[model samples]
Each structure stands twice: as structure tokens, then as C-alpha cells.
Target: MTSFIRVVKNLLPVILLVVVASSAQGADALPSWSEGKTKQSIVAFVERVTAEGSADFVPVPERIAVFDNDGTLWAEQPMYFQLLFALDRVKVLAPQHPEWTSKEPFASLLKGDLKGALAGGEPAIMQIVMTTHSGMTTAEFDQIVRDWIATAKHPKTGQLYTKMIYQPMLELLAYLRANGFKTFIASGGGVDFMRVFSEEIYGIPPEQVIGSSGKTNFEVRGGTPLLMRLAEINFIDDKAGKPVAIHQHIGRRPIAAFGNSDGDLQMLQWTCSPPGPRFCLFVRHTDADREWAYDRASSIGRLDKGLDEALNMNWTVVDMKTDWTKVFAFEQ
Candidate 1:
């Protein structure tokens, strides 16, 4: 008993030190975010809405925050990661569909001529999307996506696609959730594809993820119920569709919105325009060294009008190069 008491006495200061350090860490919720106005604004907004008795205080149930996935939550440099996934899926599925060897976009893809494959424009892209995303049970598709994302690597960084998620955004999501905010994904990526990984990566469940989707057909095969993806267009959740989807899915206006491109402009506008305390933030990809940097002219994740509006409206704009202490989780 004496020895145990002596040991406890020795460890008491260390335990207290650890507790104090943890408290300090928790005090600054966004550790990956650099000390700047952008970070300050985010922290301030969260505090204002979460503080009890404050005029801007939002009820816990109404503290909704939506985030765009691709370029906002993760890197979408060379192209959207889902497009890369589709290209890889084509290569894997080509043996089963030998006709793809001669098909225009498929042929170009199989020949490693990316430019040629996409040159046909939306029609070509739709064909690719339909070919890869349809004709499978939701469970089967989920497993396939799970398998692919588990091993897929980003072309430029060679990091696992999951590892490419932005560290700062991850912290922000956690910070908001910690403050009683319900974080959701409102992205342009495929709903099924993003659902498979959103919860694991962003702490958002499948139902909370809103995005472009292919149609699904309900069927019962041999007493087994299943929903099979179909090769047809369904609702697209992008640009103007974001607020509409949010209304349909969440049934409440979000207090905060985060995004990176023109596709997100309307979502930000909708979130901030309501007659209540609101926060809108756009992430500007400005770090060419740490990550690819392109805006306005970029084919993928183009910021264009969103950047202009954010500047004009005085909405918080996070400069990835200036605001983030680290880009990827792997950096730490």
C-alpha cells in the first residue's frame, strides 16, 4: 500500500500535465488550420452559434453544416477522384465487355489516350459513368467500391485515395460536430460512391450524403430483396441542385456551408441568404507545392464565379496555401 501510494504520488503531476495539455488542445479545435482570419472567423462562427443565451445561438437540432466533398474535403487535382475511379473500373471491367475495346471512349481509355476518351464531352463521360455505375445490387456495388477505395492510389501523390482527404477539413468537421452541429456532405460526386466512404472519412452517414445519382430499380430475386443500380440519370446534386437537395433530404436550412468551386456557389448562397445567423466559406486551392493549385480555368473543381462571389460578399475564403498548416493527414 505504501509503494502504491508513492507511485501514485509520482504519477499525479504527469497525469495533471497530460490533462492540461489535452484541454489546451481542445481549446483550439482546428489545430491543422493556421492562425489567421479565416480560422478566426470559423471559430468565431462556431462559438457564436453554440454559445447558450447568445442572440446567434442555434438550437442543437438546427446546427446543420454541409460540406462539399471532392475539392473541398479532399484533393481533386488532375481530375475528380470519382472519374479516376471510373477509369480504373473500366480497365478492370474491359475483359468482361470486350466490345469496349472498340468503343470510342472506351477504346481511347483502353489505349491510355485519356484526352481522346474525354474529347467527345458529356456524352462520352455519361457513357463511362453508366458503364461503371449500373447493373449491380447496392450491396455488391458497395463491396466493389470498398475494395477499390481500400487500395486505390492517387496518381500524383501516390497516397491512398482515402489518405488524400484534407486534414484541415477533417478537423473542421470534427470541430463542428463537437459543437453539436450535424455535419453532412452535399457534393457533386455520385451519391452511391461517396456514401461508401463518407462515413469512414467524414463522420457522415450514407443518408446524410447528398449528391448526383444514377437510378436504382427495386427487385426481389429468389426471395432476396435488392436495389440494383440502373444505367440512367437521376437527380444531380450540384450548383443550384445543392439547396434543393438539402431541402428535400434534410428538410432544414443549414447554418453553415463549405465548398470550393463554382458548382458550390448556389449552395453557399442558399445557406447564407436565409434570415438568420449564417456562415459560408470557400476553400481556394493556392498551394501548388503541397497540392495542385488551379481556380477559374481548371476543368475539375473550377472555383470561377464562387471565388468572385466569396470575395464580393466577404464570405470567409480559406486560402489553402495560407490557411492550412498541413494539407494531408499523412503530412503529420
Candidate 2:
């Protein structure tokens, strides 16, 4: 063999090894996540928890990871998506209820005075929700929510609400699942409303989701059994209620929790307060240019209390602008 040909053949194994190593590295667990401390911390935590015979290793069944939907998995800015659905439903049901034409909040809403309508606070908002959400079968409500989310566009962004989900989070969820973690969504959004799309959007089945809910009754309609939605409030799964709902639904405590608002404080606390190894994450909405930049002052998904506790407790806080290279899947 020629000297030059022999040299090329001798280097072939090294070149192939380099290509294989590069390919493995390129297949990152969190592609949208930048190479930073945040990513390193997450990877290290997962490794520790999943490694066989490791001190922090958790069983596959006990690898529960809970995530808040709004502002955590997706955008909640402008307003909660459920509230927007309620508003749209009100418009659709307006002609049926002529009383809304002269009502306080409804009248303002019908007149395009959104600010005035929401000025009455939770009471008025509840009124809208009960009126539009109730008096219908659970199946009917599900269809309504599904239909609305399919077509509704964010007032400002003009993009589908589901499209606003953080891209890095999708990768995180998949990564955790790959490591034998069972992911769930624990949010303050309406349970039925979220169930309409949670499985499709987040890969979380309806049974694994915990959220606020209203009373329901079994009724016979056209000789078929149906669950009729009631106006009475059954539960509010926000703030302190998050942990309560988690206990009621999930039974065991989550080893990891992810959220973006003060409403999720209790859930994160519950996850991290235990003695064993745990992970708590808070998504800081800091990318105003790419998405939104609000925390303390925002009426929707306010992160003030959670932010303070996260810093003081040393919980992982993901800085959207710095830690994430791409905010949305669409960007990639």
C-alpha cells in the first residue's frame, strides 16, 4: 500500500469516532435551552435522580413531575385562557339572554368596555364564567372549549394560544418522561376546559390533571345520561389550594414542580419541603422582546410572591431571555 493511502486508512477510525461523538452531543435533551447553568443543573438533577444505586435515585413510579399550565407550560398573559373562553362564550350566548344587554358587567362587555367589565374583579369574572360555562352538559362544555381554542387568536399576538407555549419546556417534559418520570399538569384553570386539550398539547392525560372545578350533576337528557355543569363553585385550585388539589388527586407528593406565578407557590413548597431530593422550578417571564416581561405588577399570572420565595429558597428560576435560546416551537 502507498504511504499516503495507509495514513488515510489509519485515521478513518478516529474520524468516524469524532463524527459519532458529535452526533450524540448534537442530540441534546433540551435543544431549545441554551448551554448555561440552568441547563446543566436540570441535566445533573435528572441524572442523579435516575441513576441506578445513586443516593438520590427515585423509583420510576415515584418519579412524579407536576407543571402548572398557564404561564408555565403556555402563555397566560393578557388574561387566563379560560377567562377569554368565557368572554367569547358570553358573546355567543348574548342573544339568548337579553338581560345581558342591560346588565352591569355583561352590558359593559357587550359594549366593548372590557376594562369596565373586569373592573368588578373576581365577582364579575365569576358571574361571566358561571353564566357561560354552566347550564350546559360537561360534554357540551368540552366541545365549546375545544372549538374556541382551535380558532381563538390572542388579541395582541394574533397567534393561536397553544402556539405560545415555551419550546424549551416541551423538551423538558419529554426528557423527564424518557427518564421514567410521569408528568402531570396542576393548574388553576378550569379542569374540564384544560382537559379538552391537555393531552393533545402537553401529553398529560385528563386523569392526571388537577384544576379548579364547579359542581356537576347527573341528568337524563333524551334518555341518555349526561353530566350537567352547575353554577356552584366546587373548588378553586389556586394559591394554597394547589397543594390541596395535588394531595387529593395525585396522593403522593411530587418530586419536581414547575410553575410561573404566585398561584403555584403552595405546590412548589409542597414538592420541595420534603426531606428527600426534590426540584422546584419557576419560569421568569423576562423576554419582553420575544414574549412578555411582567412579574410583580401584572394582573395576570403575577409572579411576585413566588419570585421572592424562589430566590430566598434557592429554587431554580429559569430566566426566559437568558436561559432559553428559543421561546416558542414556532421560532425553531
Candidate 3:
């Protein structure tokens, strides 16, 4: 053939090599995560543990990873998403509970005064949750949560609650799972409420999700057996309760733990304290432009002691503004 045609054919392999290299580079497991120590630490930890014959190599069955919901897995700013669900529920059941119109927290919620409703702290939140979440069968409550989560939108972002999940975290979960790690969610969020969307949104099944829960009792309603949710707390899986629930539900200590606030400090301590290789990650919400910026002083998802401890222990604390190339999946 001509000299020009021979030259093009000879250069094809070099061009192909460049294309292959570019493709491999673009195939990052965490596209949403920026290249930094925060990302490197996570990748390095997974590699060491999953590598055969490595000192830190952990067996597949022993490779359990737990994540906290709320601010950890999804957005919790503008108040907890569960609280928003309860508030909407109150309006739906308003005609039945006229007394709520005059109640302290309920009244404030009905009047769109969120600050006043939350003034009573945990007690007020508990009251609202019980009122809206109880007096129904477990199946009924499940359907309610499913329906609400499917349609609910964050007031600030105006995006569906599920869409508010951190894209980087989703990548981490998938990457870990691909490496034979079993992922679980241990959060302060209500178990049933989270179960409704955990599998759908995070690829974590309901059985793998552990959270705070209310009491439930078996009953024969209309000749059908069912569990009736009671208006009382069975467990509050936050702080110390997280470790307890993980122990009870999982029956094994996890090798990795992820959380964002003080509520998750105990879980992190428990996971990393044992004499073995462990990974503890704390996602610090430092992006006000893309998401939110709050830590020590914020009423919700406050990261006070956890922040100090993370530094002292040299635990991985993700600076959202720095570590994450993108926060939510909606972002370009």
C-alpha cells in the first residue's frame, strides 16, 4: 500500500493504548469522590483487608460494614426527614385528633412553627413520632412510610428525599460490596421508616438495617394475625444504643463504621476499639453551597465530641466541601 496508509496502520496500536489508558482512568469506583487522602484511605483500607494473605486480610463473612443514616447516608438538615414525615402525618390525621390543635408541639407544627415544635428537644420529637407512627398495624405503618418516602421532597433543595442521598457514599457502598463486604445501616432513624427505602435507595436490605424502634404486639385483627405498633419506645439506637443494636441484630462486631454526628461516636468507638484492623469514617458537612455547613453548634446532626475525637484518634473525617467532588446525585 501507499506510505501514508502504512504509517496510519503502524500508529494504530499506540493510539489504541492511549484510548485504553484513558478508559481505565475514567473507570474510578468513586467518581463523586475527589482524589485526596480521604479517598485514598478508604481505597487503601479496602485493598489491605480484601487482599489474600495480607496481614489485615479479613474473611468475607467477617467483613461487615455499618453506616449511620440521617446526615450520614442522606441529608438531615432542615430537621430530620422522619420529623417531616410525622408532621405531614399529623395534618392527615388532624380531624381525628382535634386535641392536637391545642397541644404544644403539635400546635406549633400545625402552625408551621418548626422552631417552636422542636424547642422541647427529644421529648417533643418523641411525642410527635409516637402520635403519628403508632396505633396502627406494622403493615399499615410500612405502607405509610413507603408512600410518604416515595413522594416526599426536601423543602430546601426541593428534591425528593431519596435523591438527597450522598453520591459518594453510594459509590463507597457499592465498591465495598463488590469487594465481598457486607454493608449494614445502623442509625438513629426509625427502623421501619428506614426499611421502607433503605433497600430501594441504598441497596441495603431491610434485614440489614438496624435503627431505633417502637414497641409492637401481636394481635388478631379481623381474624388476621398482625403486629400492632405501640405508642412507646422499644429502643433508641443512638450513641450507646448503636453498639448494642449492632451486637444484638448483627451478632458480630463490624470492621468498618460510618457516621456524621455525635450519635454515631459510640458505634465508631466500638468498631475501632477492638485489637484489629478497622475503618471508621465521619462525614463532616462542610459544604453550605451544595448542601449544608454545620458541626459543633448545630441542633441537628451536631458533630461536637466526634469531631474532637476524630482528630485525636486520626480517624478519617470527610470534609464534604473538600473530599466530595459532588454531594448529591442531582449535582453535575
Candidate 4:
């Protein structure tokens, strides 16, 4: 019995060594990120969480990572998906409202003058959204989104709207899943808008997407209890709304979060506020040659306060121009 016990004890150290070595090797195999502190920090954090017997080791279930959809997983310009929907809506409603032919933004939109339409600013955008998104049931709104993505093509690239997703972000999503991390899209975009293609494009299912939502009501339709999406805006999951949405929907604060604008600041702040291993990443669109690059002043995907906060917080900021080997999957 003593000899048997001695043999078992001797084998245990070897087993532990093999396990540690294997874990380290696995962590080392992460995709080749850009050479910088951001890359190093990501690798280190992942290793700490995944390493066996490590104090920071997190189980697969608890390894929740959330990412902002627009500008993080996909492109947000020439405009947001909701904005595109609103634009399409404006065109559809134009026939009924003949007066729009003479209006400022509507007149511009009708003439395919995107610049003029956008020049009217947020009020103009809200008017478009209200006209289209409101006065419809949830199912109808979802169908509208589904139909649009199915047929819509980007104006400049002439590529299907869904094809505009960032390639590196997609690879990162896949990599996280492989590492036993549960990835989610926490965006300010509409929930229904994202759910349409999130699964097909990002491999993240509808349930994993939490976003802005209109008021919903449970109604008996044909003796069946159906959830109806009302046009009344219930939440705007941007800025401060992001953290509130995260708490209400996800139930647990994300250990890792990725975002690209000031809209994501509150979410990142919330994620980092908790006492535990955490990481926050900001995707800075600095590659005008490869992708669009307008930060502080850009009307879309504005990154002013968030950029400064990222610097102060020591958050990983991904420079699209420098860090990314490729921007879009469709890019040659």
C-alpha cells in the first residue's frame, strides 16, 4: 500500500506539469493580433482566466464577453441599420406625402441626396425613424428589417448590407467561443434589427443580442398569447442606457466588453467598475485608406469622450488603420 501510494504521488506532479504546459500552449495559440500593448494585455487576460489552478481562472459559463455591434462587429456607416430603414421608409412614404417633394431633408432624400438629408441632423433622422418604425406591431417591424437586409445594398460598395461586417471582429468572436467564452452583442441598435442577421453573420443567436427596444405587450391573438412590439420607444440603449440594459438583460456584468464610441462609455465603465478580472476594448476607426476614419467630429460612430476615457482608463484601443490586417471580409 505504501509503495502504491508513493507511485501515485510521483505521477501527480507529472500530470500537473503536463496540464499546465498544455493550457499555456493553448493560450499561446490565440490568433496573431497586432504587435502592441493591447495585444499583450488581451493575451495575458485570456491566459489568466483559462489557466488551470489559477486564481483568476473563470469557468466557461462565467466567461461572458459582450461587444457593441455597430463599429465593433460591423460597420455603422454610411449610416446605422435603423437609419437605413428610416431612409427606405422615407422613400416608401414619399408617394403619400407629396409635400415631402419640397421639404428640406425629405426633398434631399427623394432626390437621392444623402448628404443633404443627413445635414438636417438628429431631428431629421428621428422624423424618419418615427414615420417608419412607429405605428407598427413588433412582428411587422421585424419583417420590415428582414426584408430590407435581404435586398439592401450599400450605396458606394454595392455590396449586400450584411457583407459589411468587420473581418477581424468576426474572427475574434469565433476565437472567443473556441476559448469557452460566451459572446454577446450589446448594442444601441434596435433588438429586432440586430436579431435578423446576427446569427447568420456573427454566429451569435438572437437571444444573445441585447439592444434598444420599443414597448412590448402580451396580447391574445387567435387565442394565443403573443408578444407584440409597439412603436412606442421604451428604451434607448446608448450611453447610460447601456449599463442599465446590461444589468437588466444579461444579469451579470460582462468580464470583457468591446465598443467603438461614446455610446459605449457607460457600458465599459460598468464592466471595469466591478472587482474582478476584466478587459475593455475600443475599436478606433483610424484607417481611412482601408475603412472610414472620422472620430471626434463624425456624426456617425462618434468617439470623443470615449477616446479620452479609454486613454485615462488604460483600455485597449484597436487602431483600425494600424492594428487590423484586414477590415471587411469582402475587402481584397
TM-score for each model: 0.92, 0.92, 0.92, 0.85
* lDDT of every predicted structure (CA atoms): 0.92, 0.91, 0.94, 0.84
Model 2 CA deviation exceeding 4 Å by range: 1-26
Could you tell which candidate, 3 or 4, scores higher by TM-score? 3
Tell me the tens digit of each residue's lDDT in model 2 across 145-182. Answer: 88888999988788898887888999999899988999
The order of the candidates by lDDT, greatest first, is: 3, 1, 2, 4
State the local distance difference test value for candidate 1: 0.92
Please report the candidate that would top lDDT against the real structure: 3
Per-residue lDDT of candidate 1, residues 1-332 (tens digit):
99999999999999999999898657877889999899999989988998899999999999999999999999887888888889999988899998988888999999999999999997999889888988899899999899999998988889999999999999999898988999999999999999999998888999999999999999999999999999999988989999999999999999999999999999999999969899999999999999988898998888999999998999999898989999997874
Q: Estimate, for each residue in 175-265, the C-alpha lDDT of model 3 and write its tens digit.
A: 9998899999999999999998899899999999999999999999789999999999999999999999999999999999999999999
- Backbone clashes for every candidate come to 0, 0, 0, 0
Off by over 4 Å in 3: 1-26
Lowest summed lDDT window (length 10), candidate 2: 20-29
* lDDT score at residue 167, model 3, on the 0-100 scale: 93
- Which residue pairs show collisions in model 4? none
Clashing pairs in 3: none
